[model samples]
Target: MALAYDDTNIFARILRGEIPCDKVAENDHALAFRDINPQAPVHVLVIPKGAYVSLDDFAANASDAEILSFTRLCAQVCTSEGVHLAGGHDGFRAIANAGPHGVQEVPHYHLHILGGRVMGPMLARKA
Candidate 1:
């Protein structure tokens, strides 16, 4: 595989406005959009603005501000998606795909926030 992911690639295109997406939320550091093929009722992908191969790449290059933004965005998406929080009414899950073997289709760093209804156990615990 390439040393690093190319932004001009698919997910990056979506992030750059080269292609349209069901954008949920965005800031100077990150972007959130609905998953085209959602596994759960609410499946939003929160990705960084810059190009990074995967979660590892993001961790390596992300600044303190970027890291904070990513965490805040994740919480925001959970709220927007109605995921149970301190006083939230619904439930949600935050998922990040790491590498090829981990089922990462997109090369960009993103977190999939899924919710809207009760879901079964996580992949490891799924029947």
Candidate 2:
């Protein structure tokens, strides 16, 4: 399905310099920043500099350089946040929500890197 990306989304605004973000790291194709409403002690968001509405959109459409930049930034954030296993930290969770079922709040593709504490089960058991 072709998802229509909303350029007016908050992340788009941030990228356009209309909104300020607590930036962690950035490259030509991607940007990593601290989430304003953090859910973990180490909460960083990695986003590609393209108009993608979801992870699948990014995966299928992004160029090799864009993909590499986004992936590298994610790893960079993990290590710098002290959550990378190689960095002697337990680990971190990378989450990308999509569509209505995924409860995606923004229309831009973004990865949430959460860590600094033991994250319990990936999700609550469906009752």
Candidate 3:
């Protein structure tokens, strides 16, 4: 089931130009910008221009062209940001938080590209 699209989300505002963002890269289908609160030295966010609540929503509702474009734009952003350096010797991590359990703060779907340092484990081990 597709979730309702929230046009009032911060990302939507950014995409609509209602708000300003430190833009990194933009293509026909996606827009990338530096995160206001970054977790890593190189923290960028890539989002599809279309409105989707989460990754599942995006996968279910977005067109094939939108999917391909968004994915390609993400890789382009990584390359432009030099995240994958020296022929992939250095790499970055792309993350998408889902619902409440996944810690998704924003309603709109986005991919967080984090790198520029050794990204440690994703979670701490439970003792």
Candidate 4:
């Protein structure tokens, strides 16, 4: 299936400078910023500069440079936010929601880095 990217999405606007974001870290291929409606003490969103709709799309379509830069930026944010396991702080959770089942709010490919406290179960068990 062809991935549809909506340039008018909030992340796109932020990338285009049409909107402002509380930037945490940035590189040539990715931008990490604090989530406006944070779910945790350290809730940040990292988005690629490219136009991709979801994590699968990004993994399949993004260039090596884009992938590397984006991954590195995520690590950078974790360490800087004092949530990286290597930093001797509590670990972090990296989440990428996709499609309707995932309840993705934005149509752009973005990774959410959440930490600074226990995250509880990965997901509530469904009967």
lDDT of 4: 0.94
Candidate 3 residue pairs in backbone clash: none
Candidate 2: tens digits of C-alpha lDDT, residues 31-126: 999999999999999999999999999999999999999999998899889999994679989999998889998989999999999889999898
Query: What is each predicted model's overall lDDT from 0 to 1?
Result: 0.82, 0.93, 0.90, 0.94
Q: Each model's RMSD to truth, in Å?
A: 2.3, 1.0, 1.7, 1.1
Clashes of 2: 0
Q: After superposition, which runs of candidate 1 have C-alpha atoms over 4 Å from their true positions?
A: 1-3, 124-127
- The full ranking of all candidates by lDDT, starting with the best, is 4, 2, 3, 1
Candidate 2 Cα RMSD after full superposition onto the native fold (Å): 1.0
Give residue 35's error in model 4 in angstroms: 0.2
**For residues 10-109, could you state the per-residue lDDT of candidate 1 as single tens digits?**
7889876789999898887888999999988899999988777777788888898898888788888887777857684766777888776778887778
lDDT of 3: 0.90
| 32-54 per-residue lDDT for model 3 (tens digits) | 99999999989999999998989
Which candidate leads the pack in lDDT?
4
Q: Give the better candidate number (2 or 3) by lDDT.
A: 2
Task: Mark the 10 consecutive residues where model 4 has the least summed lDDT.
Answer: 1-10
Residue 3 lDDT in model 2? 61
Off by over 4 Å in 2: none
